[model samples]
Target: MIDLLEIPGFVLDDEREELLAELRAIPGTAATVLSQDMGGRVQPNVRKTTRLAVSPETRERVKEWLMDAKDVLAARFGVALGDCEDPQFLRYEEGDFFVPHQDGNTPLVHDASRFRRVSTVIFLNERSGEPRQGAYGGGPLVLHGHYRTHPGLRVEAPADPGTLVAFRSETTHEVTPVTHGVRYTIACFFRAADAP
Candidate 1:
């Protein structure tokens, strides 16, 4: 009886913490700062993302976790588990942050790549300190648009560990700069059909 109609937070407490700790040591590369747009970009302090290539063991865990989660959500929402995809893990070191923007359309073929539907982010842990940044500022998930139905919408994700958030891919959002430490999380994007 898994409940999943709209957005619901699912904490993978069992091994999420342990898996993230282990992944932290796997080695990461410097992330390129991307230009901001509806196509979200320009994230600093971010290391390697799991979607590219992962170790055999890491890959297995990621696939299994996503598949299981997807199944639960699918049954709850009355949707079939049509397909499962790899999970993405992102690591942000001290001062890492992302600007406001919408997720860019996937590399489209015949304009069909615009298939990304939902974006799910699972907070692994915060190696960073300070519950809240000083008067100066800190990281926050900003999704522009509130009052008037603007182009995009803003939502701040909790810095707490075990936080899982899922939103429509078309919704714009970003992680503000970390005035403090590192941020780690696993993210997966779901689509109704094949990636264009």
Candidate 2:
């Protein structure tokens, strides 16, 4: 079974808190999915979350941090990675979720996403089974094993604050519905250095 690379404390406590504060202060727009025909479109059934419009300064800072993970991800996944795309600051409240889907490099898509080789998610808060301060309930990130090799295998990613989970862009995964509190994360994609 393929396992996800989990880097604990990928974001330090101070940095995470600062990021959270900045994100909370800004308004958000509905997150969208990339469509093969029309590009990105809001499809609530497939994904339900808010995409924060972070300041350019924040975006650059986050991109730099995400870029720092490229070498590690490339070595772990045995893939050559080039640039890290602008990270998306996402917020998931109660009832929010993303159904099982691949991030990129699939025949179903013919957009810029096709160049994605690695996908990353940085958790900003802890997850609890029940309501608790600075924690969210449910919203487990479930990573599925390749169908041909380990069908039915599902791994729930760790929800520790500042943790980063990296996986192949083609891996099927989903975020289970959040039951309480709020879930915040930064999602980013990495492409090959030679990709057009």
Clashes of 1: 6
Q: Model 1, 72-99: lDDT tens per residue?
A: 5655544443443456566655466655
**lDDT top scorer:** 2
What CA RMSD would you report for each candidate? Answer: 6.5, 1.7
Q: Candidate 1: minimum summed lDDT over ten consecutive residues — where?
A: 33-42
How do the predictions measure up, each by TM-score? 0.66, 0.95
Which runs of model 2 end up more than 4 angstroms from their true locations? Answer: 35-38
- Predicted structure with the largest TM-score when compared to the true one: 2
- lDDT value for candidate 2? 0.90
lDDT of each: 0.53, 0.90
